[model samples]
Target: MMELRWLEAFVAVAEELHFGRAAERLHMAQSPLSQVIRKLEKNVGSPLFKRSTRTVELTAPGQALLPYAYRILRSLNNAMDAARSAEGVPTGRFTLGFSGMHNHDTLPRITRALRENFPGVDLNLVGGIRTFDGMRQVRNEDLDASFLGIIGDVGTPLRAREISRHHLGVVVPTDHPLAHRDAIPIHQLRGESFVMGPVDGNSSMTVAALQICHAAGFQPEIAQAVSDPFLIVSMVAAGVGITILPSEVLPILPEAATWIELEGDPVPFSHGVVWSDDNESEPLQAFLTILDSIFPEPTLQ
Candidate 1:
């Protein structure tokens, strides 16, 4: 029978597309990795990869095997997690994803409440590329849940529980002319050298900012592309550029920058907790209950 270890080696290699790099990722030697791949191919009666000195490509069988391998491994891990939860030890670990955009006002309260109520649960928090990435991960059973800002059409697939809303705000340097305004019109930002995050993938902030800019009648002349929203303040303070973000980010504003409310509700940001339709974990259910206690009128979809 083909062993799980052989599948693990194959998956690692397939993902990395290089035996040496895959070996390093697995913290094993190339010799052993090669041995395992060969053993797997021999056991399956076919070569899973076509390798040259420069590149590694998956064979048809390899392509067919990857998804099943991932699903099997995930199922095994889930079974183990379930077994641990059922051991009568009264201790469990629940992993949830978090984007930096979550509300500071409620998360601490939520965490504290969870700790106080479920003393046995170790609330595992993982950071993500974006909130929507968490939704994808949840669907894959990689996470139990996540807290993130939902944007247009991105959170449609996952079951979203609305936690809070944060209207868009303009983040600018203290000395910038717009800093003096109570709020600024979107089109007034035309021709400004804006700092933007990547809109590719599930980056809602970037998508919303660009959409707002387009509505305002021009594409922003981007000065810098930053990944983290918190870092945008420093860039703005350094006179590199300005950015638009959610009102929830106000607490993190440095002395060099301040926020002005946007002129209209162009595109507002909503904080939501997302999970897969398949998730029915106890810890996740407990979390939903605590969330209900905190925000009673929570909207679910």
Candidate 2:
């Protein structure tokens, strides 16, 4: 049977690319490390490393196994941590995820609430590259909760509570022709060069921005597609192209960029707190309660 220790040894050797360093890292003798690798190879019926007097390189098989080994190790660590956390009397330790776009505004208040109300809880905020992936983590119990934009698609097994809404707006260069306009009509931006975010499944902002352009009767000519909002704003500042972003982004706009509210019934973006139905942790519940108190649902007239 392939042992976990052997896999660990192989991974260390593969990463360090030196038996001596790998052995030192594992706090073991080089001979035992070499033996472990041999055993692993025998078990798999294939050599994993190409070793010489001065160099130790991964074989094709080793290269292929590297990603699986790392993933397994990460999963094992997460499982052990989760087990240890659950075994102890649940005092507090909340892990939250957030989309990078929403974190600037929501993180401070969330952290403040956790500090004031659930002082015992260790608040860990993780930034995610994509909203859907972050939502998946929340649903999978990897994250206790997350704040993400309201994705019309890619439904999850978690419940979401709407917290805030922001209007869509255009970010243009300060000296641009439309800079002084109170509100820019979407039609006027047709065929205009744009700096946008991921237009695929990852970002709702990108999808909505494109939809607005298409509705205005012409597809936007994209100059760049960047994932980071700050980078998108910076690109616009550099006169790359105009960008459509949430109004919340106005406060963080670069000095060279000016924000203009989009005229007509522009699509508003919403961000919300999400958590798994199966996550019954007291800290998570307490955190949710704090969120409810801080940002209560608005009563419509």
Using lDDT as the measure, the top candidate is: 2
Question: What's the lDDT for candidate 1?
Answer: 0.79
Candidate 2 C-alpha error for residue 59, in Å: 19
> Stretches of candidate 2 above 4 Å error?
1-92, 153-156, 298-301
Query: So what's the TM-score on candidate 2?
Result: 0.70
Q: What is the C-alpha lDDT of each candidate?
A: 0.79, 0.79
Q: Write the per-residue lDDT of candidate 1 for residues 69-111, one digit (tens) a residue.
A: 8777766665665676685433356787876645456768888
